[model samples]
Target: MDRSLRNLAVALVVGAMAPLFDSTIVSVALHSLAADLHAPVATIQWVSTGYLLALGVTVPVVGWLQRRVGGRRLWMAALVVFLVGSVLCSLAWSAPSLVAFRVLQGIGAGAMLPLLTTLLMQAAGGRDLGRLMAVVSLPTALGPILGPVVGGLILGAASWRWLFWVNVPFAVAGLLLAWYLIPADGPRTKARLDVVGLVLLSPAVVGLLYGLSGVGGSGGFSRTAVWLPIAVGVALLVAFTLWALRHRGAALVDVHLLRHRPLAASASLLFLTGASLYGAMLLLPLSFQELRGTDALGAGLLLVPQGVGALLSRTLAGRLNDRFGARVVAVVAFAVLGAATVPFALMGPGTPVWVVVVVLLVRGVGLGAVIIPLMAVGFVGLERDEIPHASIITRIAMQVGGAVGVAVLAVVLQRGVAAVGPVAGFQQSFWWAAGLTGASVLLSLVLPGRPRVAAPATPEEAREPVAA
Candidate 1:
């Protein structure tokens, strides 16, 4: 809210844009990339899959990295790594090379994502979180609006290489701003890496994510590739949970934090949010292209109204969350989201464009309204030291939940198409997505209501200096 916290947010948001933009932008270019590199679509898919898996492996390790290195240094260092990865990706000549480079980029992103929340929450000293998250959500709001459109335009005008080149400006600008704007952190803690926990958790995340990723391509969860890794991931996750319970505060993730009711509820709701948001994303663009015969660019252009709706709702949603608390806002938001999604389920091949666009706008508003409260509530009563672990917990929940949503919907879409027709199949999937969102409305009832006035900053928080 104050000048220093605002500046820190600006710096982090600028840096965060690289990954957020990179993911969506690169997705639009996958077909172009497959053709350019002379690779099969299946092989080229790794360019995205490898990055996601690498990201999953690295996320659980970030809380440890931040404690060891300090936030400012860790953030800037991760930015540098991402910058380098971007440059390498631009030069990649083969599919394998590109996938490897993306893995490097993912490692940098995994650290930055959660660390961004940890730094801002720490600096705010538990004050004005709803307002701060609005600022934090800016690139998130902008990414959907801009990333696909920008990718489409770039591919139209230039070679696919320009896609990677686009990140150069954002990364460079982010680095320069961070150097002067972000307050330097104090001495680092001597927290030891939980090697055993990392061994269990990181692989568990990769297996789960990788396994889920295969479900759609392999036709169903019945395939060995689809189920084997997932089974292993689930088993390892159970082992890690037991391990973390024993270690308590010292574990890689601190599974103990789930005992905090607000956090527990927020984490669960966040999983549903991830499912609704990403599952729909996969469906929307494809629906336009497949059923409406829109090209990638046209489909992207048609989706702009949704992005605009999300952007418009963000600030107001934050204010409402601050005033009425997460419970009321989230319940209404999810209800709106579910309601908007229903029209899509009923849409026919002859459905009017204006009708679809209007629904998307309403859907986007629901999307924007739901995020602020869920993101902020988990930290409400947490101690400063606990913030990093909480960040890790929420981020992982969202990521894993997203994978699950996408995988399940993909399978559903495939079977629906096989059993019914194409148009009918898509309708079935939309119904499923709407149902998942409706479930979130019920879950939101448990979120904390009418937030208390922020407690006074601790002596340590007060003493932490910032630039005037």
Candidate 2:
């Protein structure tokens, strides 16, 4: 990578960290949020679910939005929106209001996430994708480690409002750095906005996610309420896929990209990876709090070693992916993840903390290794112009996988808790998580073999809007 591209990546990563960490920061504060707002646990969950749905709602339109407004301006604008929403969320007096403000925050966050990847790779001019992903993944590697600990510290000493307040400095600093260091947005010239396509795609994603999220509270997919939205969402998504197939490049998300072997494999693997990684995160904290009687902060602190392990592996994983290929690295990583998860699958309440800590550290390394490679390998053969489409497609897959994973596992966990005990509940969830990653080991076979040094785009291809 060129020095200039490296500098841009760093600046973009700094901005990227703000939205990336916000939800995770808010995760540990949910129980506190319920108490303070005097709301039922069911209602309070909207704080998280609403944010997730809002993300789904915004993601499909972002590729168009990125082109119409230009990425730099759109990013800054999204940050400003997030900052305003954060301040509003901090001041919310009720659960309903907090949930509403979180939606606003989520919209900004939704746009920011995919754009972060698009802007960085677009600037890198498609060189050394694996190395680029290594740098760009800093927030991903750190968020799991620091977010809960930070959230725990705030909730331990201060009001739940401080959770939203903490995002201010990062948002402000990121905005400033982006303004100075990032290039200005290119002129807006995009393929015509596909209104029908957007109508079908956006609501389809939002409804699917909303329905999946309801599965946890409703107990399972068997409930009418849980299944209804899911059925409708799936129908809508199927219709949209048909529409995209007819229109080809004119559709909103360009579903045609799935034909690319690397993109398809990477997106599929990301889906399962999201499910496994996210499901484990949900189970770990709640189980620690319920079964071990650890406080929120204490639980967060206990997970720090996992974060350390991920941080330690970042460079090594990136080098290996670039050199040896995503296939080998991803397969080995998934195997390690599945194997490390075994102890958790069998763990009891009295299982030693030292053992959990060791397992988490190793598991974190496997997760970090697999994710960085998958993120890079998808773009191996794409032109710079096609990146935004790939970005949206991959993001949607990963996000959907994560929400469904947590929901299904949460229902499973609840049942296990009712049947046996909290320890047993988490144990069952870990088994499911292990199974998810284990399946991905087979899916990894489809990833591109040892990557050949890719060809860069022509000068004109680099200049076209991402939607082009």
Candidate 3:
């Protein structure tokens, strides 16, 4: 990529670090939040849940928003929203207020997530996509590695309020860089919003996320709180699918894009990869805490090897995707991920810490490798207009897949603990995660093999705001 594109990536990724880092940091501080705010853990859980639901509600609207206000303006505005929300969260006097502010933060985050990918992919114009995704995905790779460690250090030194305060620098730097570096808005389009599609899809995603989050507390899917909303979410999702199909290109997310083989395969594989990654995440810390008797910080430290491994593999994975194609890279990634997970399944409390660390390091490499291919492959043959929709679709697929994975694994872990014991329960959960990874390996075969070179965009196409 050129200097301009590189700068754009740097600006966007820097801004994105606030939300991504904020997520893992806040996760580590939940218990502290509960105690400090004098709220029940269940109530404090809303701090995360409310933000996630807001993200679900807002993510589907981004394509429309981007068309309305261009990527650059939309990005700055979202960053500002997140910045204000973070400050408000730091100042929060009560649990309800904190959760409310976090929802605001989520609104910003929801827009930023898809927009980040949309902007980068559009700027790159389908060239060097593998390399582009590696740079774009930096925050993701770092969040798991640095977020917890940073959170541990901050909480150890100061008040829980600093958690939100930490976001200010990233957000501010992102905004300043964005204003100076990102291209100005292009000519606006008058594309009409599909209100009907929005009405169906927004709630559909929120319901799915909320319902799935309830699984751990409800102790399986049998509870009304768990199944009822999920059923409604599924029903609405089906309705939106039918509506999107009928609406064709004008729909909120354009279900017709699934006709593209690369996107279709990528979307499907992303779902499974999401399941594999997030499912193990849910199980891993809990296993460390329960089996090894580590606290939250120690567990966080233990998982750093995985994140380091992932980080180390980013550039290499991008090169491999460009050279060998997503199929070869992904198949091997999933295989490695599955293999690494096996040690966890077999381990007892007596397993050496070094062994666990080594396995996580290898597992992180596999995890790192999985994202670049899945994220970039879908955009292989998409048009500029189609790129935004593809971004939304792939993002939603991974998100819903993550919720499903977390819910399913939580249920498995819960049941296994009841039926067998903690060690065995964790074993069962890890095995299930491995099984999902194995499935991903099989699905990887369907991805596009080795990318062909992209032609340069025409001057007129390059000047268009949407293309930019």
Q: Model 3, residue 269: what's the lDDT?
A: 92
lDDT of 3 by residue, 100-144 (tens): 999999999999999999999989987777888889888877785
Count of backbone collisions in candidate 3:
0
TM-score of 3: 0.96
**Predicted structure 1, TM vs. truth:** 0.96
Model 2 per-residue lDDT tens digits across residues 1-468: 788787788777877787788889998888888998999988999998899989998888888888888999999999999999999999999999999999999999999989989888788765677778888887876786689999989887889899998889889888998898889977567568988888888888888898888887645888888888888889889999999999986888888878777788889998998898788888888877887899888989988988887887778888888788888888998998899888888877788999989998998888778888889877766776688899999899999988888888989898988898777778888888888988999999877667544433675443222210
Off by over 4 Å in 1: 454-468
Check candidate 1 and list the clashing pairs: none
Alpha-carbon RMSD, candidate 2: 3.5
The lDDT values for all models are 0.88, 0.84, 0.89
Give the Å shift of residue 332 in candidate 3.
Answer: 1.0
**Native RMSD of candidate 3 (Å):** 3.6
- Report model 2's TM-score to 2 decimal places: 0.94
Q: Report the error of model 1 at residue 363, Å.
A: 0.9
